[model samples]
Every structure is written in C-alpha cells, then in structure tokens.
Target: MAAKKPWRIIPRPLLETILNNHAQHHRVPQPLLLHGPRGVGKTTLILQRLLPDWNKGPHLTGYVDFAELMKGNLGTSPGPWASWSTCPQPRLSDCRKILEHCVESMVEKGVSAGTITSQQIFTTLNKWHGLTAALRHVLQSKSRASDRASPAALWERAVFAMSRECTTAEVGRILGFGENEKNGLSFEEASYMKESVAALKLAKKIIALQQGWRANAITHMNRTGLFSRTLTHSCTDWPCLLLEFLSQAAEIDHFQPKLVINNIEVLKHATVNSESTVSGPLYHDSLIWRIIALGANERCLPVILVTSDSYYSYEAFLEFGYMEIFISREVSVEGLLG
Candidate 1:
C-alpha cells in the first residue's frame, strides 16, 4: 500500500466560536461536540492547537482518548459482580485514571503559574499516591481480622483524613466558626467551603478506586452486603466525581478548566454480545450521561467532545433529553488541504 498522506489539521471556526462564547459567558457554557468523518484531524487540531493555548492562558486543559481506555480494559478481569462482568467496558477504572491525570495536570500548571509551589504539588501527589495504596491494601486483604469495616466506610474515613490536617479549633476556623460569630457562615463562604471539601473528598475517592480494588470485592460479594453497595455506588458516580473535581479545582474567580474528550464515539458504540442479555443503552446511566448533565448545568466547567461517528449528532442527543447539553459543530480536513 502507498504511504498514508500526512495529516493536516483544519481550523474549526464555528467550534472555536462556540468555545470562545462559553469562555466569555458569565455562566458555564454548554459542552461542545465536534463530529465529522474519519481521518478528519478532529483530535489533532484540539490536542495540538487548542489545548496548548488554554494551558498557557488562565485555563487548564485535560484530554483523554476513550478508545485507548477501552483497549486498556481488555486484560483486566471484571469484579465479582456478574453484571459488571457482562459489561464489555470497564468504565469505573477509566474515570478514575482520567480524573487523576487531570488533577496532576492542573497542579503542574498551577506550579508553573506560581499559584502553587512545586513542593506543595509534590507533597499532595505523594500523599494521594500513598493513600491510594493503603486503601487498596485494606480492600484486598483477605483476613477479616485486619479490618472488618465496609469499604465505603473505610473510603469515607480516608477522605476525611485527607481533607485537612488541623485541630478541632482549626477545623472550626476553616469552616468559618469564629469566637465572636453568632450565626453560621455567610452564604458565600459556606458555599465555597462546601464545594472545596466535596472536591477534596471526590479527588481522594477517585485515587483510591483507581487501584482496581472493586475487582477484589467480587470475590467477597456473596459474603458481605457492603461489597455490593460499594461497587454499585462507586460505579454510578464516576462522572459526578470528575465534575466535582474540575469544578473545585477551577474555583478561581476568572478561569475555567477546558476538558477535551477524544473518540467519545467509543462510549456510544460499545456493545456486549447479543446473547449477554444486557439491556438499556450501553452508557445510559454511566459517566457519559453525567457528562451530559454537567454540560447542561451552568455550574461546572466547559467540556468538548470530539468524535468521528455521525450517530452522535445534536438530534440524537436531543432524543435523550440532552438538547441543552452539547452544541454540535462539524469540522472537515478538506477545507485545509487546498
């Protein structure tokens, strides 16, 4: 076969216009969907041109290719839940990795911008890694004598510990508890702290689950009810956890993090064997839906999804009642070749 032509990236003016409008809006902008034919350089233009610009400015950018994520899930065994095993894709772990990577990228940008010190970044990342390992050990331990607590309880305790290190008084101060204060926190401060703590909790949870301990829960599923709850709960909140993390991290007054999800078609196209009896859309209640919700809500950061499949059109998303979630834009490489 002849050598494939060098890929050329076309400037997507319409998509860029949508992104700019969202960035300048007083409220959170709608998520954007870039759909076109295969080999159109949709992924290239964003990764090469757009993301770098965002990173250099006030915004942070994160990119994840769902196709690669699917490939990574192949060698891994599904956890004890037969339902989970029947699903062709392992999404929980994928979400965990994506969140972790995004946070790490954000911190690195903060360090470079002098908003956060390098030492602080290293300390936080190291602590997160250590906590992840410890949580994994606790979950995978076969000996009941080691710890009989449910994984969710253990995770909650871990999150509480990671939130902040302080005495009772310090905790009160962080929460705006003052000696002379009569009433609770002001609305603004209360909202900020609530959001901050929630984000920290979610970050810790994502890291812990990234260890793939849920697979171990399957072995003990029949013996303990907690395992089932833990598995189901974690699986359901992957997207919410990510949105929380992004929202909290981008709490800066002026800047919003830009999230780019590449090859989102994978989520739309994934299917199990026809004989498997799996009902419902492949990703109906999964992270994809949460992403749509985040896109529709004005509270979260901006998200951009790039796909080659025509099936993921605006009308299709509308059928799912996500009409306000994504602004569809088509890009073509043919425009650049000339």
Candidate 2:
C-alpha cells in the first residue's frame, strides 16, 4: 500500500503516541488540546486518523460531535442551558446533552465489545454509590411528579426529595449536612443542593441497558447506579462516573480510555437567556472541570478537546466566560501543507 497522506500533515511523535500501545498505556495525557485555524486539519486528523486506529488499539474513545448534538437535540440555538451564568451561580443546564451522550456512548461500546458482562460493569458503578442514589432519586421523584407541573414546582419537589432536611435532617447533620440545628438551610446552600439534586437521573435505560433479547435486566443490566440511597461510598457526579466507566471498560483489554470532543466550539454557542442578567458566580461549570476532576484529580484518562477558537485557553473553557485556568499540556496543529 502507498504511504498514508496523514503522515505528511501530522507530527511524528504525536501520531506515534496516538497509534502506539506502549506510549498510550504509560503516558497520562492532561486533556490533549488541538487548537488551530478552522482549516488546519484538526478534525481531519481525528476523524481520518486516530479514531480508526484507537478503536482497535489499546484504547477506547467516546467521541461526541457536540455541534451535531446541539443541532439535533436543542436546535441551532439553544437557550439558557447552553451557556454559563455571568454571576457565581453557574447554569448547570450545560451538562444536559453531555450526560445523555455519555450514556449512549457507553451502551454502544458495551454492545460492540461484546466481551465484558453487565455484572462486571455493575461492579464498577457500585463503587460510586452516591451517583447511583442521585440517579434513582431524580428518576423516581420526576416519575412521581405530575407532568403538568411547572419547572418551579418540579424544582421544589427536587429540593424536598433530595435535600437532607427534607429526607433525613438529623441523620444528615450526623453526616455533616446542616449548618446548625436552629437553621434549616441557608439560601445559598439550598440553591446549590437543589442544583445537585436537579442533576439527578441519566435516562431509565441506565438501570437495565440491553444489548439484545438475551441481554435483558437479569443478564445485561448495571443496576449499581440504583442499588443505594445514602452516600456511603464515593460521592461523585455524573462525569466522574462516565469517565470511571470508560477507564474500567478499557482496562478489560489492558488498554486505556479517551474522550474525544469534536467542535468544542459549540460549547460557547449559547443564545442568552433571562438568567444572564443576574449577578452570577464568578466561575462557571466547565467541561474541563469534569475532565480534570477525573484525569488529574482522580484517575488518568486522556481527553481531546478540539476547537478552532484561539481564546479557548487555560481557563476560558468551552462555555463559561473569562475565568481562564491553565492546561499544562497543549499542541497546536501547525505546519500542515497543501
């Protein structure tokens, strides 16, 4: 066969790291960044090169074409959920589609691999009991509430169902949940708690993801995310759980896992909603926060965030504005020839 043309446009070392097993297995990548002008072959390299090889290599990739995700799910211009608030209170509406995509990707990988069993996956998720309860409570509460209820009404129910004061105040106090016996919850605490509670659930399929007829609840369900209530194990969020699942699945073949976010620019593509006017938190919930919390803070999963925008640096993040942080490792896709 003729020599591949991508070899000419891509750097040798980066290409080797992507395609080689020894390099990928040992190297703990810190959210690998590919930033350049729109036509510099970044997406070309991802779609045409790394993706093809990585699938069969000692690594698994959960690729999310976020631009398409936005258009298909939210329309060309998504409202409040698409952007972060200008003040301290972040618009967690940011994580909506991402959560769905992660679950879908997991199901796809599980079905395609056909090597691992639901029991093993269940074992993996069971370790993060808190996430399990969050999903269960979110789903159950939402199920119980009337569909005609307004968003405000639903939020009140979420606070009631998920809050310790509403569920188990004394027990929560023992678990260090309250400020003092005299007070219930400060406004800020109640807000953040409801935010976390509002973030519960990841589609009902999570309870019993099926591959086929032979793969029903009995044999192919990862019910670990629904088996508990109290936060006895690790109290993690959804992204952490998704990344954990990716790591666990890859480890089955002694490989690694990676997150490929194409067109990360879509993250900033928000149509301003009414909440943008309020005094929001200084910082916003970030895609990078999700990755770093798991990659550097917890495990060693590599993430690839591709964007053409020059300003998506250190802390600029995909959606949240202006709180730029540092990404220690970066590679500019430069010197691509005609």
Off by over 4 Å in 2: 1-23, 26-29, 69-95, 111-236, 252-255, 271-284, 314-338
Against the reference, the lDDT scores of all candidates come to 0.49, 0.44
| lDDT string, candidate 1, 1-338, tens digits | 11133433555775555556655432354566765555555566677756776765466677877666555444554421112223366353354456556655553343223333222322344442434445445335422323555444545454444444424343344344565665355766544443344334435455456525554554355345332433443444434554544554464544566677777655544453322112124333355566666555535566666665545553455566654456534332122321
lDDT of 2 at 257: 58
Q: How many residue pairs clash in each candidate?
A: 1, 9
Q: What lDDT score is found at residue 222 in candidate 1?
A: 33
User: Clash pairs of candidate 1?
Assistant: 80-218
Task: Give the least accurate 10-residue stretch of model 2, judged by summed lDDT.
Answer: 275-284
Model 1 worst lDDT window (10 residues)? 273-282
lDDT of 2 by residue, 1-338 (tens): 21111222556456435434332552343555565555556567777767776667555667766555344444343442343222222222443346446644553444234323333434454454323333344547355766566444544454445444334453333224455544466777545443332222222233322112122331222233222211211112345555655554555355555667776655444332332111112111344555555555545556666665555553355444323332332333332332
